[model samples]
Target: MTLTESSQSLDELLKPRRLFRRLIAVIADLRLAIILLLSIALFSISGTVIEQGESVAFYQQNYPEDPALFGFLSWKWILILGLNHVYSTWWFLSLLVLFGSSLIACTFTRQLPALKVAQRWKFYQEPRQFQKLSLSTELKTESSSSLIAQLEKKGYKIYQENQAIYARKGIIGKIGPIVVHVAIIVILAGSIWGALSGFLAQEMVPSGATFGIKNIIEKGLVAASPLTKNWLVKVNRFWIDYTPDGKVDQFYSDLSVVDKEGAELDHKIIHVNKPLRYDGVTFYQTDWGIAGVAVQINNSPVFLLPMAQLSSKGSSRIWGTWIPTKPDLSEGVSLLAKDLQGTMLVYDKEGNLTSAVRPGIPLEINGVTLKVKDLIGSTGLQIKSDPGIPFVYTGFALLMLGVMMSYVSHSQIWILQANECLYIGGKTNRAQVSFEREFLQIIEEINEAQTPTLSVANEIKN
Candidate 1:
């Protein structure tokens, strides 16, 4: 057989059950766990190292000299293995899936047996067995039957007799690990789902501006929606508070949501950390501001005007319509025609007329150059949405609860008398030492009940 065929045969020999065992062993082995963890860490570093979601041309322009190396590291290989985004990497996700599967298998294999043992209330008790118990005690009485009767009266069910006795308490204490293991799977699944499908992003809603999901990043299979149809979100107003040093202290945006059908749902004011949620979309107060540029041109204060100037302001500004004004009549320049470029007029009143002067360009007229003086540059805001956040959060909550329940177990005991010997025992799924102490206390209480006369005698003698 070929080497490939041999390898496949070997793999076939280690199918499902053996593979599961191997995964379990790896997960259980601290070394393998650490190795997998380090692998994940190293892969995650790649995501942070390389810029994500850039075009092919961008990488080519940036790394022209190292095309092969760049291709090997970039989206080329990332797309094949999903490593470009490490968190969503198929192998990484499979590792998590396999880890959970291993946990389930381990729970079934080892923990289930332990649980069965713990659930059994019938413990084989011989004199030798009771003698070797951590909490064994010896009691001598004239009548063993009377002692056993007393123990029965105290509520302990007696099983077997003669030289020793056996009893059990609280047999349900073995489910803690099972619960914890299940919870871990739940939490892991929830986190993975959140990473894959849950979207988190922001959008800036300027006052009176209506926008849609176009501002949100589309990942997985989320369809690209127009900036208007996803959701008609409007910012009614926005405000910010700042410190004396101009550091921002707090900010808020008053927002309203309009559905695709143009129906208003709810209006709310959102602040930092205090977000406004609507129809699975959550609006957070990321930032706010206004932006515009101040413009100036020529020696005169520039203002927008139509092709024809209708009136003159401040003696320098002129506005008019229908009648074409001759620049030469007013300023020793002859007017030829006027278009969008500006008035076409000649220097020296009637000599060769020059070309039209534009608004922002410099024109040489009698040794004077008219230049555009200034143009000033405004505010930026950041925004986001995650429709599946609630599901993710719910999953997280369940995971925590399951973990706690699986780790903490409830166990208690009831003391009773069967034939006159005190029977004491307790059970718990956690903190066996604590339960043991409680059992010891119960034994002491039984002794006190049986020895009250002796205690009274001692007290009287004292």
Candidate 2:
């Protein structure tokens, strides 16, 4: 290749490299980082305000088509924008990835380089450098050794070359931003990992029933395998406690984790705000309801009847079931229950109220003697698994530590000895007034020490 062509080729190659450097510089800018942070925060707020991971029908009902919510949002818009599952959406995840990239870029381009500069030691070679300092003083001293001792006593990391000395303190303050960036990266990684691999499922298990996880309401792409092939949980028993006003105070479920061989691995009695955890899975007690009722007819075998939740139109809770009193598919009565207290209201086939009976009560209905058995209750549980929570918490802890460390002032001092004159100057990244006061105190001490030396020299001369 010709020399001119080769030179042109090299310049072209350098152009792209220079462009890339400029881009990195822009991305690492503090203003840019603040803008990106605020943007991420705004999107996160949107995700929280607009419900996530809901059924299509639910969105359609809540955010209708005609009026639309806030005159702009509708079910179609929500589905199209992936608002139903915002955190797991491609755009939202991409935003997080971009923010993490920004953090990395800033850490490498700004924080680490600043720390390196802070760690480096440079001797003051000229008096002009001292003049540039915010706090500088010219003083006469006997030797540099005494000043070195004072600097050491003040906790400065001293570096000496000939008669010039350089000292710095609070270098950790320069390292704090790097730690903060690293912590933010860790938290972002944890959040992405959890969103990609976590699953949320709900189960309404009747007491004394053993089942596997089958009812998955929300799940990520990789979450299905973990849930479908996991352990079995059994509801040992479910009950409720009532207060003085006959209102339910708490509901509890005795749950057990059983292995494939039916051996119990763990057990716990869980209620509201209390949960059972085993093998990375957590089961939370969220609700309770009536599952079924057991009843016996005169001289007949006992039978269990499943109860169905009745629509109350926003007034009260009720569950109902029909029990056949006769064998010819006729002469049946309706049973209604309101709570776990086991009080059941009976009605005839014609919908007329018959009687209210409790458990172990005998009632004569349709010329048949009937005895009420136990009312079975079902435990509503929400199950979830997230492997990244530990990382997230650790990241937050580090973030707080980094913030505290960043508060320390990074201070630097330079000492120059030239032609029987001493020049000293100091500066700090923060707390300017306090640093000024400290510098003045050091000057005062040097003046006091030199005054006695000057007095002795004058007496000897006389």
Candidate 3:
């Protein structure tokens, strides 16, 4: 081959190596990692501050454009930027993958190499090498075996050569940062997985009713349909416990999981903060409502009147139903109940207050005897399923272990006996004061080992 052709071929071969090196350098940059972390934090804060998975009318009403929220956030911008569902957005997930790549690059390029170097056995062969340590001292001594025994007593892993000894401890600390980075990456990946494979659903089922999951407000892009369950859920009964003042203290629902033939598979009574898990899906009791009121008009068979929720300010809820007082349907009375405590306010068609009534009570309203037999209650449940919870939990466990391991201080000591002078020094990556005190105590013990019996042994050997 001609010299010019050989040079061109060599240049072509080096281009790929140069590109790979540059890529590694960029991904392992500390500044890039910091920027990515800060960006993730800021976007996470945004996701928390903004409510997610609401209808368009809700956002338009709450975050109007003319007077936008915080002077910049509007319904238009929220939908445009997908801030409503920030965690599941493509850009946010891309940032996470990029940050994870950076962590992996740094672990391979810097942290692993450092740990390998720390594990390597390097004997300080020359006295000058001991001088390079942060703490060093020269003692007029000859016996290196006594120093080796003292170091072994102090929990150091020892390696001995002809005249030099090397001891190290806390090598696990060097591996801690790498584990921490891996744990964070795992957590991020799990979060992304959950955002793509989980679902959230809400249901308002009346007492003594069987239903399938259908009302899904928010779900992952690739989540399985919750309706694929082989079993059905039945709300056997719903009730509330009232305080002494007739206020709602707690609510509960009796639920049953039934198969296609209506045979019960499992049953449980669930309340707030206590949920039921079945086949990876969790059901939580979130709300309670009045489904309907059963009433009987004079000599007429009892019939159920469906109650509708009335909009009110604040957190209080009220449901109302209207019953015809006459067969002609010309006059009627409205029954309004705030809770399942069996008390209701009765109003006439003319908007005049009639009387207060309770269940199993016969009341005379609008010249007709109206009897309220019972109030049917309904249970509202929130359902959720996530396949990534185990991964997240595992990541958190590893993170705690890594944090504890990182606290351990890695210390190394090197000693050499040359020309009747014992040169010794040590250093620590952390807790320098403690290491210094330990090093001094070891030196003091070595000084004490030079006894008269040892000198007689030396004379006997001569």
* Best lDDT among the predictions, by candidate number: 3
* Superior by lDDT: candidate 2 or candidate 3: 3
Pairs of residues at least 3 apart in sequence or in different chains that clash in candidate 3: none
State in Å the error of residue 66, model 3: 3.1
285-400 in candidate 1: lDDT tens per residue?
A: 65443321112323545533222332434443322222112334344333222221233333354456465544356666544444322221111233334344555566567666
For each candidate, give its TM-score against the true structure.
0.58, 0.93, 0.94
lDDT of 2 by residue, 338-396 (tens): 89897899999889998999999999988899888899999999888877777899999
lDDT of 3: 0.91
Off by over 4 Å in 2: 227-230, 448-462
Candidate number with the higher TM-score (1 or 3):
3
For candidate 3, write residues 178-211 as lDDT tens digits. Answer: 8899899889888888889998889999999999
Cα lDDT, all candidates: 0.52, 0.87, 0.91
- RMSD in order of candidates: 12.5, 2.2, 2.2
Candidate order, lDDT descending: 3, 2, 1
